[model samples]
Target: MSIRILTAALFLAIMGLLVAQRFSLPPELTVRVAASLGEDAGYGFGEGLRRGSVVETGDGFLQLTIGVELENLDQAKTILWLAPNTRIELERLYEDEMTIRFTRGRIIASNETDVPLKIKTNYTSHLVLDDVASFVNYDFLETIHVIPLSGSVQVNAGSSESLLTPVPLAIHETDPVTFEKLEVNLEAGDAAEFYRWAGVLTGL
Candidate 1:
C-alpha cells in the first residue's frame, strides 16, 4: 500500500512540473525592431530599441525619416517609410498572426512565410499572403491604396472584400465594403515618384 502511494505521489509531482514548464516557457516569436532612421522613431512598451529589440509602435507618429524594418516576428518583415504625420501601432502580434494599425501613411510588407499579416487602417483591413509576395499600403486623406507589388492579397473593407493581384487599387473610406473595384490607378509619374521614395528610404 505504501509503494502504491509513493508511485501516485511521484506521478503527481511530475505532472506539476510539466504544467509549470508549459506555462513558464518563453514566447517563441517576437517582433524585432530591426532598424530605424530619423528622429523620434521609437517604440512603445518603454524599452529602448537596439538591433533585436522586441517592441510595438505607439500612438504618435513613427517619425521615420528614412525607413524602419519591424522584422522577424513569426517570419514576417514589414518596412515602414518616412511618414511624419501618420500614426502607427501594433495591435496584436503572436506566433501565427500579426495586426498593424495606422491612421495615415504607407508601409511595405513582405510576408512570404507561414505566418499571416493583417493591416488595419482607418476604414479597411488587408490580409497579406503569398509564397513570394510583396505589397504596399498607402493611406491617403480620403482613400486607402493597396498595391500588390509581387504576389497577391485580400482586401477587406467593412463587409466587402476583394482579391488583388499586381494591380493598384484604392478603397474610399465612405463607400460600403463590397467587391467593387474603383477606376483609380496609380499614375506613371506618381508610381515613379513613389518607387523613388521607397528606393531611397530602403537604401538608408
Candidate 2:
C-alpha cells in the first residue's frame, strides 16, 4: 500500500475509536424503565424506551414527561420518578456518584444504597450525601423546593450554601436588590400532599 493511503487509513481508524469511546455506553451504568405511564412516556434519545434497554441522554439536552420511572443499577439502586412536565438530563451515573440536572418540574429520587447523589437546577445545586430520598421541584427560575427524606441536604445557591434538615423548604435565589437567600417552609400537610400529587402525576 502507498504510504499516504496507509497513513490516512490509520488516522481514520484512530478517530473512529475516539468517537466510540466518547459515546459508548458504560457497562457499569445500567438503566431500565421500571414503570412507565401516560402516552408521552419514552426515551429522550428518540423512540420509546423498552425494558432492559440502556438509556443515555445522547448529545445535548433531554427531557422526561409524566409517568416515568428510570432505574439505575449501581451499588446503590437509584429510582428516578418523573412528575408531569419534568425536564431533566443525567450527566453522570456511576456506582459512587451521580449527577442529574433539572430544567423544570419535579422529580423524586430514591437511593437505596449509600452512593452520593447530586441534583442541579438553573441557579442552584444540591449534594445528597446522607439523604437517601429527596424531592426537587424547579417550578420557576427564582424558586426551588427541596425535601430530604433521610439525613440532611446541602443547598448551594451561587456563592452561599446552607444545610437543611427534613423541614421541606423552598430556596429562592437572592436577587441583586435583595442580597439575601429566602427559604419558605411548607405547611404541615403540604409535604405529604406534594408527594401525593407527584405520585398521581406519575401514576405510581
Candidate 3:
C-alpha cells in the first residue's frame, strides 16, 4: 500500500477507537447535602447514616440535592423527579463547582413521611423511573449508571425490557415502575435530543 493510503487508514482506525471509548465509558453522578441547623456536619459519599438521618426542613419540607452525570441537559431531566411543592434548581458543575444553571422545577410533596424513589440505567438503557405497577416508561437505553438520591430503589433486567422498582414504605407512597428497552447511540448529540423527546412524552 502507498504511504499516504496507509496513513489515512491508520488515522481512521484511531478515530474509531476514540469514538468507541467515549461511548463505553460510564459517567459519575455525585450527590451532596448541606448540614442542617445545629447539626455538626453532613454526610459524604459512602458515609454511613443513621436509620433516620434525613431531617424535615424547617418549612415543613425536606431538601435533597442530587448531582447527576448527563450527556446533556435532556438526560438530566430523565433522572430527576420534581414534586409540585418541592423546588428543584439545576446547576452545571465544572471540576466540582456550580458553573451554570440549566433548569429548575417544583415538586409537591404528597405526604409528610419520606417517599421511596428509584433511578435505573445500564449499557442498553437511559435513566428510567420505576413505580409499583410495572415498567411504566423508559427513555433511550444508553445510561451506564444508576444513582438513587433518596429512599431505596432496585433495578432488574429482562428480555426486551428492564425493571426499576421502588421499595415498599411504611406509609402511603408512589408505586415503582419498569421501562422498555430502546436502542440509542451514546456517542452522538442525538442522544440529547432523544432524551428531550422522552421528557416531553413523559411530562417530566
- Model 3 RMSD to the real structure? 17.4
Question: Which ranking of candidates, highest TM-score first?
Answer: 2, 1, 3
How accurate locally is residue 172 in candidate 1, as Cα lDDT from 0 to 100? 67
Candidate 1 lDDT at 77 equals 46
Worst window of 10 by summed lDDT in candidate 3: 104-113
Give candidate 3's whole-model lDDT. Answer: 0.29
Error of 1 at 71 (Å): 12
Which candidate, 2 or 3, has the higher lDDT? Answer: 2
**Candidate 3: residue 161 lDDT (0-100):** 45
Q: For model 2, how does the per-residue alpha-carbon lDDT over 167-187 read when each residue is reduced to its tens digit? A: 566666545311233344433
State the displacement of the C-alpha of residue 128, model 2, in Å, after optimal TM-score superposition.
Answer: 2.6
RMSD after CA superposition, every candidate: 8.3, 7.9, 17.4
Superior candidate under TM-score, 1 versus 2: 2
Models 1 onward score TM values of 0.55, 0.57, 0.22
lDDT per residue as tens, model 3, 1-204: 699999999999999999998786443234333112222223232232222233222222222333432223222222322212222233332222221111112121111112223222222222222321112122232222232222223444434544443432111111233333333232256233323322322432
Instruction: Identify the runs in model 3 with alpha carbons over 4 angstroms from their true place.
Output: 1-8, 11-13, 16-30, 35-64, 67-156, 160-204
